[model samples]
Target: MQIATLAIIGASPPVRLARMPHIELPRALEDYFAFAETEPTRNGRRFSITLPYMDGERLDRLQWWYHVSPAQEQMYEGTGLVFHRTRAIERFCRHIERWLEITAQRFHGEEPIPRLGQQASSVATPASVELTPVDKVVNA
Candidate 1:
């Protein structure tokens, strides 16, 4: 199945990614967030949630992938599965919903960073990312 990883940029704990396609993301994401070695880009910070395929509950391989950059207001999405399969499409949709739920919880509101006499302007707000087309990513 082709799976897409949701990403959120500019948020605290600046790196987060889904580890598996079948597993749901935890409510408290303290230890679940991940960061891979990627080249620096104009976007503030890139957080990825890559979803690998499951073979009857066992992870087989990565098929589809997604990368969201809130700073750049962009989402890159792609899949590698052949078009002849319908299961891949269904799995991808399920992954997308789960990803959205996790993102909503992680970035619900602007909880200002606590600092004595800090200017409000210095605070950051949630912004939309631009969508970019990409090829599916494989785990290295």
Candidate 2:
């Protein structure tokens, strides 16, 4: 088994638009990501999600480190998914796909954006389109 973590860093506008007002990046992420709880820290919230193997064994984890200072300030966040089982890599990749989709809808008005670590290349595909391979997504 191999262990690794993949993350994407995204930024949202601080000021509210005429239609969309007060979209707090961290709060929006916590709401859409659907994590159990956030640990209160001096700076912000520490959110985590854990997935175990089918045999009820602890194996992988996805962690998000988010910090928001003041309601109207820009949000800087990192979302990382770590896994130890190479066989279950596809599952983790799908999870990242959904996370990015929801986040883009919430903040970017459903506009398709590029992958986190890549240039201005489009990452969005239609519903009928097949997803990119797990290796590509992980490397992206």
Candidate 3:
């Protein structure tokens, strides 16, 4: 059994977009799921869909680190752990699929924009002019 970390974001409850690593799938598995939607994120984007899976736990601690931590550095600061279990890969896939579908439908068109690192150098405008560049000239 392999462990996978799925990220979800949206306004509504219990819906999420999942980002998964590339892997091979059996032909029989393709029919079991459907692509529901896609949404952008701070880094890039995510895709959503529906599939089959069993046993899902909405983790509070994990959610806090993944979703809430980056919002305000002073408030919540910590590293997150991966929650995993030995279950059928199919089941894991399915659970993520359902989450993606729900999250997509809720925040369909709107996606969060990532914050840029820092503000650029302040540009002085005519109204806020301090000193003219001509005044700095030295007589030669």
Best by lDDT: 1
How far out, in Å, is residue 112 in model 1? 34
After TM-score superposition, the amount by which residue 8's alpha carbon in candidate 1 deviates from its true location, in angstroms, is 12
**lDDT-best of 2 and 3:** 2
Candidate 2 lDDT by residue in tens digits, 18-64: 22221213232222332343655566444344432111232333543
RMSDs, each prediction? 25.3, 19.5, 20.4
User: Candidate 3: worst 10 consecutive residues by lDDT?
Assistant: 59-68
Q: Write the per-residue lDDT of candidate 1 for residues 59-124, one digit (tens) a residue.
A: 432233333344323422222111111233345545544654554411221122111121124358
Model 2 — TM-score against the truth?
Answer: 0.22
Shift of residue 26 alpha carbon in model 1, Å: 9.6
Query: Would you list the C-alpha lDDT of every candidate in the order shown?
Result: 0.35, 0.32, 0.30
Off by over 4 Å in 1: 1-34, 43-45, 61-140
TM-score of 1: 0.21
Per-residue lDDT over 1-118 for candidate 3, one digit per residue giving the tens place of the 0 to 100 score? 3443333232122223233322223222223344432354554323333343221222111010012122332321221111111122235455544554544311111112111122
Root mean square deviation (Cα) for candidate 3: 20.4
